[model samples]
Target: MAQLTVDIIRARVEEDWTRIVEVLNRKIALQSISAKGITAEHMKRSAEFVAEQLREVGVDANVVQSHNPDGTPGAWEVTGSKIVDPGAPTVLLYAHHDVQPVPDESAWRTDPFVGTEIDGRLYGRGAADDGGGIAIHCGALKALGDELGVNIKVFIEGEEEMGSPSFIPFIESHRDEFAADVIIVADSGNWSADIPSLTTSLRGNTDIDVTIKALEHPVHSGQFGGPILDANTLAAILIASMYDANGDLAVPGIVAEDPIGGLQRDLDEATVREDSGALASYRFAGTGSLAARMWTKPSVTVIGFDAHPVEGSFNVISPQTTFRLSLRTSPNQRPEEAQEALAAFLVEHAPFGAEVSVKRGENGMGWAMDPNAEATKDALAAMQEAFGVTPINKGEGGSIPFIPELQRIFPAAQVLVTGPEDPKANAHSPNESISLPGLKNNVITEALLLAKLAQ
Candidate 1:
């Protein structure tokens, strides 16, 4: 393998961004909401489009489908051509085509289904989250093949937003076909808009719905106030007990370790509040650096609560109340163990005579990359060469369930999480957007990294 020149890679990326944006916009226009998932028609169209583009660039590409157990739309894979060298290390580039649902149209400034460009940012649902990253990877490969004569396989899944339940089965069935020396997950964002980042850890997640039942129906609150058990109040008490005053999770057996350090930065509270749509006075619990508190500690958030309405002022004791609890465990914790601890806490802490039931939802283990891996070194070098800045290693607070599965299947493979997205990309939220500059940088970096991996 020949040494890749940064200037050549940058030039190729500059030449390809225009076409890449067009293709990405086309893909984003289709509503591939994972909650509704990708329709057969939509998947077929997307696959066809990708296949055509690969052929146009004189690369071998094809859409491989894996059927669901019941014979539904199980999973889909798009494989590209190999680099010239027969022994070149195969690199699997992973992205997801599916996105979360757009609940309210009025919440968006532009059509969520339509990709809109405003103030140098492309606005759409999945623009930055995964679409931009996907485009960068595909575009970089295309440009490298045409301009630098390199090749890499591309594997984009359609169920990532849905916890990627189908990914493991797909990988297991097609293990040989998906073999890679390293995997580049371009679904994360940088530490900040300007600073490049490689995510080294991801917290695991578990969902539990706790329901408390006391009375059969709503009774007059004034009359029943004295002794009658209020399900809502009981539920609140149970929920509140899950956290200590310091904002640290009170769940048993879940240890909160100090973050690896160095990822800490003084985040402006005002900026955080504005970005998170919280009041200026809004504050997070726990003591530590923001990054440490966010990515290292266990967090318990009551995502959903079911109770009586405030408008009705229902002077009654509610029969039943339920709250959906989402637990983000530490990087090394097992989600199932966390779930068990949570269930036990809720069950043992329930109010007297109140029936409390805990139902476990989806659970996934966290992922922590080996910092000493060779592939990581190559990736860092590639990023430095492309962006002229060393990449920052950090941890994402959210869970990408499939990462653990991938790690289990390919224990020796190095996994690096770097992408085109940024902090302000508004991923999983309204008016999500991606910076054009970031997209271009990702293309260049990925292209250079592909060359490095091949070497």
Candidate 2:
């Protein structure tokens, strides 16, 4: 492999800027929303589009399909490779080709399917969330060309927006084909447009459904309301037990904090409140810095509830009620264990001897990467050089289940999560975008990291 400096990589990425935008725009034009109404052929087209770009950059790419749990056809997956040397370390790049459903087209300033550039940022449905990711991989490969020192593998799935139901089966069926020594997941966002970041940790998630039954059937509220509270009231008690007066998760056996030092930086309360769209008078929950509460601590939210609506006069006492609990565990805790603990808590805390039943939903494990590893140092240096600023390690409050699954399947591989999306990217919402300069910098950073691994 020929030695390449960061300066040369930056210059090459700059030269390919126009082509990168063109590719991103073309990708944006394809509405690959993997939802209920979308068809298999529609998804296959997006996968083939990505494969075509990879092939153009000298990668042996193909659009493949994985199976669902019932042995039915699942979402399309694009897998490809560029092996420079059998002896060199292989790096796997991951990003999704599908996007979230646009709930309201009228909210968009520009057409969601047409990539628009305004004040140096490209706006579109998939621009930053993941289309930017595809551009990064192809741009880096194109810029480095024959100078790319390490082996490269690309896995761009078409079902990430739908929770990647086929991810486990897909990976298990082709474990060897996706093997690598290093993995870069370009699905997360940086701190800001100018500040680069690497996501070192992610909170795992588990969902549980609980039903509380107080009566066999509905009875007149006037007769049963006083002696026995309605099932909905009993359900409220169970939900309130999840938190203490401090608003911390009241469950036991679930890890609460990082156990190491928490976030390196704390978020401003006002800024977080404004960004989250919380009412000014709404007091924040949980104890500790906003960053720790959001990134490292455990949280339980009642995502769904079943009860009588307030639209009509309800003169009868409800017999049963059900609610769904979405639990976000600490970065280092196992979601299965947390789920068990939560189930036990709900059963034990059933108020007024209400008959409670807990049903386990799905779970995804969390992840925490070693920040001092050799590849991590290289990545940090690459980001520093590309962005001309010090890089920070960040922890995402949300779960990217597939990432930890990849780490579990390939225990020897180093997983690094970084991307061009910023806080203003508005991913999954109206006016989604990516900074053009940030996109170029990410390409240069990835190219430099690929080169640094060679040495």
Candidate 3:
């Protein structure tokens, strides 16, 4: 990698750090949770707010309203630009402004919507998953100013955490706006707080909302206990069949690949246990090394269940049990294919004449980029330059559905996936925070890359 002057850029980023924090704080305070009745007006307000920050960074920015496939209001996006030369290659910086709902607000250390800094980390629901992401872009662009090399396009998505249900239509509606030679996605994470990682592969995701009915209404346990196939019991049986005795997903038809790519990492038991927060006595599930099963294999998890809690004692049996199934597919598979296979498996295995129905939800394809691509080459070099170390290349277990879709949309462009989260960052879970120093360094890295890409 050739050396270029980034000292000024570094100092400039430092100068903007305080304002960046304020942006993150303001963004975190917005309860832009999409799944709930959080109105489109509120979501649009956040998008417009982000556009304000980008304009401060010298980007030509605007708030764009879009609609769903059914023609209803969709994600309100903030699109911005800072084009140095029309002939120069373009880099699209991507991050989402929307966030997940605080399911267990009581578990949070601070108000989940209030961004608080404690012990060097910013804690908030969207701090890392995205509020921090937006701040990073704003800081980097602010530092670069008019001298930024590449043609820049900044896109802040509105409904990413809601599985981006309306994303496909939105992107299609404005395809030319997002056209670029390279895309920098700020939704991924570093391998560790200290070790920077370039994610070359991402897992795909699918969801199924299933309801199992054994009876039309709750039945008395005393009168019909003996041979009763309660909905709850039937649902349990169906879920149990998803995994084999070895605790691996037993479903057929889902694709699996050998975790032997150039970017694969060897994650040992200690690393898995540390990241998972599993108890010391707990044993791992699935065959092969933890990394192989996690990064290169398919897995099924029943994410949400609509049933009675164990806290209250009940004599009546549930008539129907509903569950939200979340399945992670390997990079070798498409999400739609996996979703179809999973739905069939559930229906075929319904126990004891139980009426089973599966409702499929939005699904996304996984992405795997060529490590040999020139943009990949430039990015790896830029990461090493910014972080002052050779970045570790690895595949991530989490799904960023848009990456593969972007690839499908613009096959010629290179997509560099990077982020500020670590194992301790705890993105979706409670106590979620973005590492401050790590965030700053990532900004520097991206700023340097933007400068390099311009050349």
Candidate 4:
């Protein structure tokens, strides 16, 4: 790598910092919630906005459309300036434009759809998790359009928060256009406010709905007392069997060992509990290293329950009960295998005379990247030059279903993950925000990366 002037890059970032923030806030003001999955209108508006920005920078930009599995129109891709050499290694910059829905408006400090800034933080629904990241990439491209002399493509998805169901099909249909030597996913966050990090792995996820049935109809408790089999009681027993006294998962086939080389050093237990808003004396399940249990082990959560409330309770035995189960599996673990393990456990341990039924939903695989790849090295170097610090290799517990698909299609490409969020970004929660300093630094880093990749 040739020696680059750091001062020049910093100056470019500062020159356009305010404009970048304005663009991000403006887009946030437009509600493009894709929680129920991406609609045709959402794709259209996002594509137009991105293309307009690229055009303003004197770069040729266009959108490529694809269809969903239901034969309905799906997402659109925004591709920027092309490379002179067709065989030269190309880089793809990826971010999702869609955001999760804000169901409870009254819970937020400001309008969830309206972007607001206070105390150096930009507050909005998608400000940190994704929208802010997209802005950083666009700002970087605009600032270094001429200096970054390589082929670059920007593929923004419209259905990431909804599990990216249409993204795999889109990639399959446009393999040639999406092909690249390196893919940078600006969707993850740093370990802390000052600690830079690169996410190298993500956990897989699966969901199941369990139902227990006892009788055909509800019977009065006065007449059937001590004789009727209560569905609610059976459901309680089954759920209780999922964990042991130590709070560790008691199910078979789920690995619970410490991770290789241990976990992150700054992952304090207090901070974890505080961030998750746990009770004052609450404790996490399992034992051993925190990172290992979270990133490399399996975790089960009871997401929802269907039952009669005490306020509306009648003196009768309920006929049915249902609950939802969510599982997070480690990298290299098979979703099918985990699903089967959980199902078998419930089947064998179900209470006597009670029929237990389990239904599975869409399952996605986990991902782990090669940290020593050339593109990753270049990205790290570029980030170091831009931020004046080295980035730590890390793993994320959340899953992105489209990542595994992208790797499958472009088997040889390196995937680099980093973004503008820190530990306090509060993505997916009330009052979500992004730090202005973090956004500006990310813009500088991405611009430097473009120039480095072109070299």
Candidate 5:
């Protein structure tokens, strides 16, 4: 075996890129959708598939599962280890095998379960969200074969999209085995196909179910509509109060920051509009830099609403209406505080003396890390060399609850967040995809980072 260098690793990854893509396509075809819970056999098949890939690269791999309160198997996990030296610094590679459900298959240009490549991007249900992350880990392992100098642990989660119900239990059960000096989370996106980035911040999220009741039961609209307001109208009034004139969230106690001076890159407004698929005449919400509005400021969205359908004609005052609010808090704000504040706001502002019931749902804490940390510097340098451009520090509006958990369990470990996704990946949507060139570059970057860690 020869010494591992950036040039050597890049060449190996390029030489074996075709096989890597094939493995990802095979993984994508399993239909391991776990968002609705991990009951499907395909989810286990996905874990076995990841273990097999690790074993191919000389890792001692196994398909493991977390236990429920009654000691029964809950969610599946694939874990493996490859140790070049007993005393060497160990690095853990993290990526999820589970994917979001394909609610509307008719909206897909290509089959959601079939990985199809068109115009240098591979489209599939999990192609970019996480299958690409798995490919990057495997490609790096294969590229650094024989000459690898550090210990590595691979953990491919099987229930992340379903909010990782068994994540904490599993980690606590195998804490010693998986503990490492560095943790590489390959589940975020890059700045662009040509520009690489290291994600350092993630916003937290909490969902609140607000039900407004104005009447005890249905009543004739023609008779009682004059004095008493309908529940629908009251619900509308409460939802409308979430935003101010500038369309920014007016929720009190939620933290917000202007990231203009801190961000390494500027989010182009035109690009945001195009990427969001917004109408030409549509207006954006909030204030400050687009990056700050998305990455640091609080935002509220109505994810689910319940009301009578127009198809069934009804001319009556509704008793109550329920709306689910998905609130994204700032990276530094506590989710509990945000949830309490929003609930209080809704109760205080209840319209027309309507009875307001706020039921709290899922709440996940946000995460933030210094980009100039030792391991992060190595990752950024590797990305810069591999992508042939200066890498940037980025923040994600999406919440990865498990990342914060990882930090809690292994406080000493340096968590470096990187991925193969680009802006156009469209993860979790109809046309989810991963850039082929971008994936290759990510593989090289990981291989270089691993080699650098050994020194």
Candidate 6:
């Protein structure tokens, strides 16, 4: 803590690239997709693999089991621990091994299960969010050996992508096991490939499934064309009502909080275009700063639909239409209230008195960290020292539902969100990747932060 040499930390990461890649490669090879696999057995095996690796570095590592609220098997948590001093605060290293399903199989430049490197970027489904994180945790422990400034715990989660259904329950059951003064979540992305960022806020998420029905059975389009109303059309109209001409969510009572003063930075158009795959001819939706629109506001997208197949001959008015909606809410917005307003809008505005049912799916509240907290400042200073650049306060558009729960469990603990993925990492999408530089630099940042926090 008293003295930190940049070159030494840099060399530590560089020298361990072989083992790092090995850990990540093994994790990538495992299809621990919690959403698709209800039992999550793959998660348990993956956690054991990580624990074995952590044990190689003298950490007391083991796999802990916890169940989801519905009694299903939740993600397995791999915990590795060491204590340099009993008095110093413990630092919890957090990340997940579960990954999102590939959007399109043909879109992958390389096998999604095989970790491959091209032009200095590792390409794979969970390479960045957060197989890379697993590597970083192992690498950092290997570097630190038994000389850590404070006690350290590495927590590798298995059900993060499934919105962490049982995270609250697990945290509550193992309150003493998770005791720590600071938490560093490595499931976030940086501002860019070259820039560093500290995620200060995360937007909450809610899923709403709606089904509209007009008649019990379909009627011939030609026979009842003028008089009969199709459920698909009514559903479409109600969906369109969610947005105004300006493209912002027009649903009544949807909350949008202002960006933290002096913390917001409007993303540049060129970067947004490249990162978002937006074409020049396409117009941007929503109002206000791009950062605010993405990070702190409510955004909706139609994620699933049940309708007639385009290739199938359907010359009949459909009797029912079902759709799944995903809503990202502001940090402080009440999830149930927003869901109630949205359900009311769809049912109240149903076309021709069509029956509409909006079923609320899983929901998670967002979190805002105190930027000026001592642990945050210590980690910020460590990041700047590691990269030779000042890291900016950033808000992640994605949701880590357990963050708010973790805060509730440890109200006095400081949470600092950091990760290795960049904008081009494309997490939760095809060709998800992490650059060599970013991977090494972020690991060094975490290692340095742990040391400084011990001080």
Candidates 2 and 6: which is better by lDDT? Answer: 2
Per-model TM values vs. the true structure? 0.89, 0.96, 0.83, 0.89, 0.91, 0.87
User: What are the lDDT scores of the predictions, listed in order?
Assistant: 0.77, 0.89, 0.83, 0.77, 0.88, 0.82
**Per-residue accuracy of model 6 over 178-290 as CA lDDT, tens digit each:** 88999888878677766788888888888899999998999999999877778878888889988899999998898987664345467788888887789899989989888
What C-alpha lDDT, on a 0 to 100 scale, does residue 110 get in candidate 4? 90
| Tens digits of per-residue lDDT for model 2, 1-455 | 44577788888888888899999999999889899522378888999999999999989999888888888888899999999999999999999999988899999999999999999999999999899999999998998898888999889998999988888898888888889999999999787888888887889999999999989999999876798899888898888887899888988888876623336567778888889999978999978878778888989989999987899957998889999999999988999999999999999999999899999999889888777778898998999989999986678899988888999999999989988799889999999999998898999998988888877
Give the winner by TM-score: 2 or 5.
2
Global local distance difference test of model 6: 0.82
Extract clashing residue pairs from model 3. Answer: none
Residue 48, candidate 6: alpha-carbon lDDT: 84
lDDT of 4 at 394: 71
Which candidate number has the best TM-score? 2
For model 6, the superposed segments whose C-alpha errors exceed 4 Å read 15-18, 29-45, 70-74, 100-107, 111-114, 211-229, 260-264, 310-320, 351-356
- Candidate 1 lDDT over 254-333, as tens digits, reads 76765543454555566767767887566777887777777878888889998756887756778898899988988888
Candidate 5 residue spans exceeding 4 A from truth: 1-4, 35-40, 102-106, 111-114, 216-227, 313-315
Q: Which 10 residues in a row give candidate 2 its minimum summed lDDT?
A: 257-266
| Tens digit of per-residue lDDT, candidate 3, span 1-455 | 12346677678878888888888889888877777632467888888899999988898999987677788877888887887889999999999988888899999989898899998899998899888778878888887776777899988888888867677777777778889999999888887766788787888899999999988899898899879967888999999988888888888888776563453457768877887789999988888767768886888888999978889968897889899999889986989999999999999999987989999998878888677777777777767766777787778777877788888888888888888787788888899998888888888888888877877
Error of 5 at 348 (Å): 1.8
Weakest 10 consecutive residues of candidate 4 by summed lDDT: 257-266
Go through the candidates in order and give the C-alpha RMSD of each one to the true structure: 2.9, 1.8, 3.9, 2.9, 2.6, 3.2
What digit string (tens of lDDT, one per residue) describes model 5 on residues 209-325? Answer: 999998878999999988888888889999999789998888788778655228777788898888778998988987787889999898888999898889986888988999999
The local distance difference test score of model 5 is 0.88
| Residue pairs in candidate 1 whose N, alpha carbon or C atoms collide under 3 angstroms | 221-315
lDDT of 4 by residue, 1-455 (tens): 24435577778778877778887887787666775546657656876786777677655778766577898876665666556457656888888777778889898999887888888888898898788778877888776756666677778777777766678888787688778888989999876555567777888888899999988898988888686768888888898898889777888986554443335463678888887788987767777677877777778888998988889788898888899999888776788888888988897888876888899976888888776677777777777777677776677788886788788889988888888788778888888899887787788777778777767
